[model samples]
Target: MIKNFLNKLPKKQVKSAESRDGGSLALSSNASTTSRINSASGARSGNVNSLENNSTQNSGVNHGNKLHDPLRSKANGSSPPVPYEALPGFRDVPSAEKQNLFIRKLSMCCVVFDFTDPTKHLNEKDVKRQTLVELVDYVSSANGKFSDVVLQEIVRVVSTNLFRTLSTQPRENKVLEGLDVEEEEPLMDPAWPHLQIVYEFLLRFVTSPETDAKLAKRYVDHSFILRLLDLFDSEDPREREYLKTVLHRIYGKFMVHRPFIRKTINNIFYRFIFETEKHNGIAELLEILGSIINGFALPLKEEHKLFLVRALIPLHKPKCIPMYHQQLTYSITQFVEKDCKLADTVIRGLLKYWPITNSSKEVMFLGELEEVLEATQPPEFQRCMVPLFRQIGRCMSSSHFQVG
Candidate 1:
């Protein structure tokens, strides 16, 4: 029976069941770092020198006019001056103008990057770097005359590729000739802006009061998050940290500042938790779920409360759990307190639909529920509790005889 039950179970479901029902566990938000684990990890390559060189080359060229631009590279004179010499957008620019544009735009993104990162506590010795200070000036004024499109492109390019790669580079390595018998494992990377700052900017832009649907469509794509998830699963510690940090912030933003984002987050998590069936990832996922609860449980909207309540149903099955029920019990306890009215409604509704609980297991499960509630009741309700205890006692007496 045990083997058969395990066979039908998916990891996320099992974890949800185990944790939601009463399983004792403290899930971590950090991605699993075991090097041997088959989780997400990888990176894309873009050479800094090549990009810089291309930018440098574009700065110095100035085409006179599109119709008769003499500065245009002469297509092999042999071939009737090829109609289009250079590509459309790369026509021409003043060297000084281009350099100023690059620096000005690059500097502005520095502000965007800072804005995205949450302000961290700094020590007395922590000096504010000059570059950081300079960034503030650029972003503040560079876009005054420029279009939002121009500002966005600048933010996208400069922010996306930079600082992401450093997350995964291994620090300590064996000195091949040292001939030491033992090797030391390196410390885990510090989590911060592991993902590109563009993600934060895109999210901010999307939620802005003046958000333009057309413009937002161009930059903010949910698919990017899927790729991030894939990278996180690659067993690369750096990628893991990056993905974790990004998701954490995204989740925080949704729960705190953007309640509208809850739908999107729930959709993303559902895909991972249900559609993907990647059960081994349950522990970390539970942490994410816990964070969601911590942030939104208080003063939850009725609609949201119902949504959360329904979401927990899939987690109640025995098939999802392999052992203890402490995690599930604790989570339910939190939900009960946060959404007492809704929880009561749910428990009453469940009792109504519960197909005749004649089995010993059902009786015991109901009995445990009663016991938990009774234990948590206040002394002031001690008199009222007597009736509840009496009713439960009657149910147990009858249930015991039927089971026997």
Candidate 2:
């Protein structure tokens, strides 16, 4: 019966179900350090040299009429306020002029517009959307490599658009027990039509072989990462899905950012578990973490173990566990698979957070517990067997027949 019920549980759309990894994470290097890298790899690409001195300092942009923000360039105070005509296509410009055109278009895109109210900035908004599509294609097929200035402009444009204050989400009506989003209608970001293009451009920019990580790191620095992390709380799932992929790629490529990224994610999880207990991207984040854990090199680090004990296990305490438990359990199983010695610690942690009042969560917990026990070693089992069965005894007598 437990097997039947567990088998019937809905599976989430986990993109990183397996480890699809590239090179080991590489830490970002400073100027002299980058010079050494340049020399070491015979200076990997022109981009490394192009972006040595770039810095990632972004003062927050001023918001205007939800659809758009104040433009960063001289265009902001222009008498008319909006640009007279759309920037010419990148392809239309001479090769020498394309770079400047790219920067100008980026500056134009920096100003976000209120798409919900199409009555405002109708022409300007259409221009930016077309420009974003052009930028995506341009980044996709740009020849040699991005220059330092170009790299900085790309990050600046991406930051300007993607990292706005998300709309106020509806309050979660905490269910004593259940598995569902609190909101009946998912709150779609009104600007997503434009925001989606920006996200795509960023994704392509990161994944582009031309956008060398060595130089890109200067702009895609820790500050950029924090801003990206904040967007995980976005009410829009589509937005979160794009964020998940971009972050995973960033983590994989920029080795230096891994510890910072993981630690920050832990902090987010801690806040979600302890303070807020609400986040749309928890499952998506766990999906990325699951991939990351799967690719863990042997002799798993103590940091990994601590993450399991601190963030991953206590995650069970949230009423929203069902929202993210599939990814959570997958992540936990990765830890155990990597180091069976952690099985005892995991079993004990599961028992510690075992649902006493929420039978639905209890069922979810039991389902995950079964997965953990399947991989538990005999010696580890002996270590926690007594308390484990003791909890099982309580669960057997659970007033909820299904949980029993």
Candidate 3:
């Protein structure tokens, strides 16, 4: 099974530039060694038979001239086609030799994004983009059961400065270069598609069943979680959509990190509210927190209750209430559902932050007040009824309603 799976790997077709000493390294067969790697990968997933049966012809390295070296052309000031070495057909090359080449090529592909200098590293954006696409494709084709070494390398690259730089906020200058200067500069800029691929790679890493345990134990840490939360403020709606799923997956898989994730989000919310920081993905983050709130254990802790009172409740006071209204309402309702005694507190908090100038918001408060009233038990409802009706009376008498 190991030999067969290795033979199915796409061999590197690119020829190395000739050395000054003029000696080419000979490719050798190491069937015995690769069989060991295949065995280990198979043992890790316990599904080698499935991998062999699903192998297809389209899996080979036939990405055209995309594999050419970018630096060579940059130095010469003229585009030249660099010939790539074609892999021998499955029948022509021994399985062992193909396996050895496959392992070596995979290693190089994983290390391509490890450059320390941003200028030099991003210059080869095309190569890095293609390599990432190929890696994603290979892993997907294998049903997300790649070798641990390959997975580790991919995690390392995504965690590097290069990937972070590409995934950060895109500059207009970079976008214009992709548009006017060089058509080949698509991935060189912080284009949404390129960032989407990086995010998709991360989504795959966290969600893949084969890598779930390792990802939870290793990649999902405090610093990584904070980075993800920071990315939640991205202005690109598409990027934020992808980030929403990635973050939810992190929250779902790393159960131990749940408290910390919630705390970090609380800090972000506090900044957005009290400190007046702008965050584009606030609605998305609130949506995730709503789900987390739904799962809170009964007789909730003081900190959790405080999060609802301080963070979740005041969140409604933001000018962009409609953006997160649904999520915030759900979270607030979940708290009331957890304990009826808290209903009065929630009602009082809503009245405290009730909008004064916005008639539409006054109307929204009525709707929310109606929901909170429905959730309150008879005693709690009676207890809070006076203040609620007083606030209602104020809304009816407001000058904005008189005009309407």
Indicate the residue-level lDDT of 169 in model 1. Answer: 45
TM-score order, best first, reads: 2, 3, 1
lDDT of 3 by residue, 328-382 (tens): 7877887898778899899999989987767766767778877887889998878
What TM-score should be assigned to candidate 1? 0.37
- Least lDDT summed over 10 consecutive residues: which range in candidate 3? 53-62
TM-score of each: 0.37, 0.80, 0.64
- Measured on C-alpha atoms, candidate 3 has an lDDT of 0.55
Better of 2 and 3 by TM-score: 2
lDDT top scorer:
2
Which model is ahead, 1 or 3, in terms of lDDT?
3
Candidate 2 lDDT, 209-292, residue by residue in tens: 898888889989999999899998887666776787678778866777888888999999999999989887898788878877
C-alpha lDDT (0 to 100) for residue 264 of candidate 2: 97
| Whole-model Cα lDDT of every candidate shown, in order | 0.35, 0.70, 0.55
Candidate 1's C-alpha lDDT?
Answer: 0.35
RMSD values for the candidates in order, in angstroms, are 18.2, 13.0, 16.3
